[model samples]
Target: FRFFRWVWRVTYLTTFGVLGFTAYSIWEARNPADQLEVDQSKKTLVILGTGWGSVSLLKNLDTENYNVIVISPRNYFLFTPLLPSCTTGTIEHRSIMEPIRNILRHKKRAVRFYEAEATKIDYEKKIIYAKDDSDVKGDTMETEVPFDMLVVGVGAENATFGIPGVREHACFLKEVGDAQKIRKQIMDCVETATFKDQSQDEIKRLLHMVVVGGGPTGVEFAGELQDFFQEDLLKWVPQIKDDFHVTLVEALPNVLPMFSKQLIDYTESSFKEEHIEIRTKTMVKNVTDKFIEAEISKPDGTKAIEKIPYGLLVWATGNALRPVVKDLMSQISAQKNARRGLEVNEYLVVNGTENIWAVGDCAVANYAPTAQVAAQEGAFLARLFNTMAKTDAIETEMRELSAKQSSAKAEERTAILNEITERQKQLRRVKQIGPFQYSHQGSLAYIGAEKAVADVSWFSGNIASGGTMTYLFWKSAYLSMCFSTRNRVLVAFDWLKAKFFGRDVSRE
Candidate 1:
């Protein structure tokens, strides 16, 4: 009886605590502290893209130090690691998205956001030409934003490698729209296969799903797709189950080249158990509406061409430079040899440019184009910019003090000199910031069936682990990394909702 009483009291207390915290969060979000209006007198810092790097910089930057302007097509910051799950309804797309307005509202100074795509950057004039690509726009839709400083964080686009019919037929999984298209297409294929008196061959073709690339995006999407069928689709549409199949094609010998060999082997084995066919040493040459032409390498050093039919083809191979980045590169002779991305110095400044910096996949800094690397680069820039602002302020004060010393009395001049010396010391300390250094924390990928693989950097060594536990860790890590507390709560609720009710199969 005493134990039951204790349990009852503890449960109510915990419930009330949760309620109180929730109320406080809601109140705080609704009523943000007033921010200082934008001052045109300050340096104009223009940032492109709403990806990992740009968002990270916005979060850490001292906005009051400069007149900040963010230009991107997207008005929300998306947590992209769980993008794959969106295709199968494991998590809603909006759950991982945080509004740009919400982010800027909490800043010390007002930051402006323009939902426009940066068409080109004029290096000589320090101007960015942008076009409002939204559906609703006024007469004056295009404009130029001039900046004293610029940060190029416009991320890369999907790479087709010049494959024929790829852009027309194959779907690229990179954005929210891409995921929605894939989701709707999956249901469309299932329904089409169930059409009355459908031919066996056509039914098989309609039920087939094909994914290209062996990278994390490809692997994770494939896993989510397979799980979608096994857990939900099979129950409602059992007749099409026997014909349902998934295939992953990769030019390389193995999937997930970035992961450890053991983890790779384990993942391959897991996929085999799930009945997902992996076609390695296969290069896709052409993608048609109903089939793909692939060159298969034989064991005896021979190549054979074969046509593989697919209902849905998802391309997740890799990234390529955007047109804006390409245009900017063409303007600079130093970037001529930069094939992958804009060549950047250790401080992430663009080569041959004094006031321009680059970050994320748009910049080649001898690092992989991943979110982890981009976030670290953005934080480093925030520190660098903050210090530069302080240094400038101190230098201005020193100049004024030196000019006053020429006319001031002897005692007053001595006092001014002492203050000037102290200011100089402070300036030196602020400018002592080192170059950007990226510390690899780790990598994680979910491999379906409640199993995941991770290569984490422990204290003094690396710990590579996989299986169900790692999947939980993957969820927790991503949830914690969400852009806002609201986003974290939404994502957590999404996971719970999916687990209990199964993923939604509705096409939206």
Candidate 2:
């Protein structure tokens, strides 16, 4: 027994030794401490915003060649396409957003991410003035971050058209806060309308929801609001039976100016059938605390003034250039004539600026401010950066080779040098590629529950699908488009839960 015990002890020690040695090997190979070192020699590529464009670029960038620093007020990349669903709790906000840190995992090197808003750009100094909001209240504590190359992906802000009282009285659906506020405000309106002491007129006005703008966002929100009333609210609190109403007002002749004529027609018909009123060609000229003064223009150039009363007003009237962007545009001579956004060249580089790039909604790419375009631009910039890095690497390799070829045979050296020259030329060619081009995958919009319209490229389609099957397709398509599979699963689960059980009405 003693002999067996001795053998067992020896075996255990050997096993432990092997395990320790293996771990040491891994530690040496990985060089954990070395990985943490920020590469100062490499070009510092500082990118603003954690939106679709910036995230895509970061994901595709060759981390080894650049010391990448990402700055944004928010650390997570929001899936904007699924954002409309968040208003009605169809998909939880967290489920749609992918943390920026997780996305940077694709990189070979560590990326420095800062949660801040860029205040100003110093072109001469090659530094950006930014405000870190980690500890501050409403104000931003400022600092400077120097960059060798910069990418401005800061997105646009919602445009309220400077209508009186619109900013204060209406809720704009742009960010997560807006969606959350809208959700809470909706419940508040419902609850206020349900008050026992409230008069019929007060209740009627409170229940009369007004959505200004016939864009996809406004239409989607209107549809979701209608669905909430029909599916959940009516069943749960039948008391507000005839109280709830949804009105969509657009200045244009039709809603969804971007979509096909058939889709717009379908949307109109769908909203009408669901008892949602659509007041097209009605421009809201002035907005009071409780009512909107609109100018209804006739086709023959005649215009009539009308007033619309409402408890809750949702403004989804597209986007305007952000103040910071506009300020930057004004300072630059190249951007002097630019009004909307930063004018960028074919390489996605801001015009008249060397080593500066802009992407997403902040870029005047002549594309809609959609996730698809932003992501595409980001990917393109990533490739551009990668190519630039490759060109640098090739140049370095050629220099080293040239040094070594000093004592070699002239003919052999020339042949080898020629090969290096050819490779450098190829790399340069890749780096010189033109600005980004956007590929349209077509549009998709959810009109209501169990009904959707997709102008997809499949089968050369201008296809508009409605009813239960279309809903399934819509859900599936959106789920697949989610940033991560985990997100997809979570969104799917949310939909299933909503289908099986009604939406949660508690304020919390």
Candidate 3:
């Protein structure tokens, strides 16, 4: 009886504590402290994009060091890794998006945010021209923002490789709208396939889904689509289930080229089990509204042209430099030879530019354009800025002390000299910041049918794992990596809802 009473008391206390914390968090979010007024003397730090790179920098940056302004077309940071799940309704799009305002509110000082696209940068003048592209705008639609230091993290765009009809007929999975469009298209195709008096040939074509590229994004999307077919679509539209087909076409020799050979083999086998066809060494020459023309190479180095019909085509070939990035490159002589993106120095400073730095897909630092790399680079930049700010302060103090020492009495002069010596040491320590370095955290991917693969860096070695256990690891890792508790909770609930009730088949 005593033990039962103790358990009840503990439960009640725990519940109350949780409720109190929740209430406090809500209140704090609603009532943020007024931001410190911008100090005119401080340097203005302008950041572009709200992607992994920019967000990471904002999260770690000391706002007191600079007056920060963020400019991006998007006002929310997307969790790109889970974007594939959104295509099949396994995870809702909103679940993975954390508003930029929500993130900025937690900072010690308020940051200026502009939901506008950076049209051009006047490097010599240290000014950026941004335009409001929204539907409704005020009298001032375009303005010039002056920055003392600028960070360009405007990520890349979808690469179509100049394939014919790709832009008009194919869907690129890069943003929330893309995922929502894919989901709607999938259902539309399924519904059309189920129309009365529909011929078998047309039905077959309508139920066929084709994905271009063999990278992680393409593979993951294929997996999620297959899962949707097997889980929700099969139960909801069983008539077209047997005719559904998914094909992944890659020009390379194999899928998941970045992954280990063993893991790649495992993923292929898993995909085969899920009835997802993988066609390697098949270069797509053209894409039409109804079908795609491809050249399939034989083992004997012979190639045969073939036309394949698809109901829905997802173009995930890769990334390309955005026009803004290309324009910036053209303006900088040192970046003229940069084919992929802007070339940067060891510290991520744009070549031939002292005040401009770049990160993420916009920067060509000889690193793979991955979220992990961008995030690490952002954090490194934050630390570098902090250190630089400290060095500046120390140097200012040292100069003042030196001047005071020259004008002071003997005793005061001795004391000022000692302080100057200490300040010099501090400045030296602050200036010793090394160049940006990246530590690979390894790779992870999900290949349907309750399976996943991971090649993670362990203590002094590598741990390659796959199967259901690895799927759990993948889920936990992504959940923990979510940008905020709100996002994490939403994602968790979505997963649980999908698992329990299955993904919603009702198209919006």
Candidate 4:
């Protein structure tokens, strides 16, 4: 009886402690005293985009050092790794998004945010011209904001490679809106296929889901679609269970060319088990409302054009430069030769220009355009800017000390001279920051049937893993990497909810 009484008391204390902490956090978030007003004396630092790169930089930046202003059409940072899950209702779209305001509130100073699209960047004048593209707008919808330093992280757009009918008929998996559209269309296709008196050929055509590109995005989406079919659609719409099919087409010889050979073999075998057809060495030449014309290469060095009828088509070929990036490149003489993205030096400074830096997909740093690469680039920029701020302070102090030495008395003059020497040494140390170096963490992808694959750096070498254990690792890794506590908690809840209740099939 005494032990039970002690246990109850401990539990009560713990519960109260947690409640108190939560209350304090909410209060602090609501009323942050560190949000300082903009200081005109400080240099203005303007950042673009709210993607992985920009968000990582914002999270680590010393806002007190600069009058920071962030401009992005999106007001939230999205966790891109689990984006595919959003398409099949395994995860909600909101679960993966963290509001930009929520992130800015923790800063030492308040940063200005504008919901607008940057139309042009006047590099010579250091001015950004942006237009308010949102529904709600003020009297002045367009404005120009000048900055002493600029960061371009606008990312990339989907690449159709000039394929006709692709932009009109295919669904993309890049944004939250795209995921929602795909979800609605999936159910729409299924329901339309089930209409009374539908012919067998039409039903087969409506149930066929074709995914272009064998990259991680396409593979993951295909996997999620298969899971949705097996877990929910099969049980709910039993009549079309056998008719459902998913096909992934790639121009390359094999899928997951970036992954290890072992993992690729495993993924192919796993896809086979899941009844997902993978067509390699096949190029999609044309896409129509109901069919895609593809040239399939034969082993005998022959090519045959085949028309594949599909209800839902997802195009994930790769990324292409945004128009804004291309326009900026055209304005700079040095960037004229650059093909893929903005050419940046080791410090990520845009070539042929000072005070401008690029990160993520917009910057060509000889690294694959992955979320991890962008995130590390953002962190590097944060450190670089912090060091630069410190160097500036030290130089200013050195100049002040030198002036004091000339005006002070004999003893005071000696002290001022000594201070000048110390300041100079500090300035030198702060300016010695080396170039940006990316440390490759690893690559991860999830296939169907509760399986995953990973090729991670282990110590000096590399370690490749796959199957159910890797799936658990993948889950834990992504959960830990979520942007905030709110996101992590929400994702955990969604996963649990999906496991227990199955995916929500109510399409809206």
lDDT of 3 by residue, 35-113 (tens): 7766657899999999999999999998887989999999999999999999998999999999999888778777899
Per-residue lDDT tens digits of candidate 1, residues 1-508? Answer: 9999999999999999988987888788778999999999999999999999999998899999999999999999989998999998999999988889998898999999999999999999999999999999999899999999999999999999999999999988989999989999999999889899999999999999999999999999999999999999998888877999999999999999999999999999999999999999999999999999999999999999999999999999999999999999999999999999999999999999999999999999999999999999999999999999999999999999999999999989889999999998998899999999999999999999899999999987999999999999998898889877788888889989988999887766
Residue-level error in angstroms, candidate 1, position 166: 0.7
> Over 4 Å off in model 2, which ranges?
1-36, 134-140, 298-301, 409-415, 418-422, 425-435, 458-467
Cα miss at 54, model 4 (Å)? 0.6
Ten-residue stretch with the least lDDT total in model 3: 32-41
Residue 445 local lDDT, model 1: 99
Worst 10 residues of 2 by lDDT: 28-37
* Native-to-model Cα distance after best TM-score fit, residue 135 in candidate 2, in Å: 5.3
TM-scores of the candidates are 0.96, 0.89, 0.95, 0.95
For 1-508, candidate 2 gives per-residue lDDT tens digits of 9999999999999999978875675454335342445687898999999998998898788888889899899989898877877887877888888888777654678899888888888887888998876765555377799999999999999898788888889998888888898888888889998988999988988888999999989988999889988998898789888989999999999998988788789889988899999999999999888888999988899999998889889999988988778877877799998877999987888988887899999999788888889999999998988988887887788888777678678778987778778877777686676767888887888888568877776655556555567767877888778886557767888988888987887665
What residue runs in model 1 are displaced by over 4 Å at the alpha carbon? Answer: 1-23
Model 4 scores a C-alpha lDDT of: 0.94
Q: Model 3: what TM-score? A: 0.95
Local distance difference test values of all predictions, in order: 0.94, 0.85, 0.92, 0.94
Which model scores highest in TM-score?
1
Report RMSD for candidate 4.
2.9
Model 4 Cα lDDT, one tens digit per residue, 344-419: 9999999999999999999999999999999999999999999999988888888877887888899788778878
